[model samples]
Target: MRINMKPEEAKDILSDMRDQHLCFLESSENKDEWKKKYLKEAWACDSGAKALEKQIPCKPEEYVPDFPYNIFSTQKCAKCGTPVIGKKISKYCSECGQKIDWGEE
Candidate 1:
């Protein structure tokens, strides 16, 4: 099953897991073997968190009128410029996974 989470929340979870593994590694009696395993996992978590931290905040650009009646409009992700052709919009860009804030519009 897929789980969705805010970038900050995911980062915090990964950072916490990395810390716990580091603590385990520090106190482990079998340093050689445990170090290899825990260190790899910790590194993975650290990188994942770092990647989330680096994502730029963005929103949907102003919708351009599509039909002559102006009932329909085409919107694009500000970061990725992936066009979204409809009135219904999502909180995140489907193409690039960039967070989108269509605030008060």
Candidate 2:
């Protein structure tokens, strides 16, 4: 699929991506507050990324899941049985460093 957008459009997307990536990378010294703040910032960045995509004027060939899909609902680590927090694409257990099987990709 080839789509030629205006240079300004491309620059907008690049700028958005860079900003979001920076937000994701920023960290705090406080562990508890860091996690909470990180998740909030990540969600904001994700929303911004989606908005940027929507402005691209192209049709998506696949689905994009909504952010914060039931924070209470979680998947268990296949090896250690510890609940996998946050991301569904997590391939490693943060607690035990064991490989996680999240079923079919």
Give the best candidate by lDDT: 1
User: Model 2, stretches more than 4 Å misplaced?
Assistant: 1-30, 59-105
Candidate 1 backbone clash number? 0
lDDT of 1 by residue, 32-88 (tens): 988999999999999998778646356578766555785656788887788766644
Report the lDDT tens digits of candidate 2 across residue range 18-104: 576556556555477666766666667566554444333221122233565654456565444566655455566666555544445
Could you give the C-alpha RMSD of every candidate to the true structure, in order shown?
7.1, 16.6
Query: How does candidate 2 score on lDDT?
Result: 0.54
C-alpha TM-scores of all predictions: 0.51, 0.31
Per-candidate Cα lDDT values, in order, are 0.78, 0.54
Single out the weakest 10-residue window by summed lDDT for candidate 2: 56-65
lDDT of 1 at 72: 54
The window of 10 residues in a row where model 1 has the poorest summed lDDT is 51-60
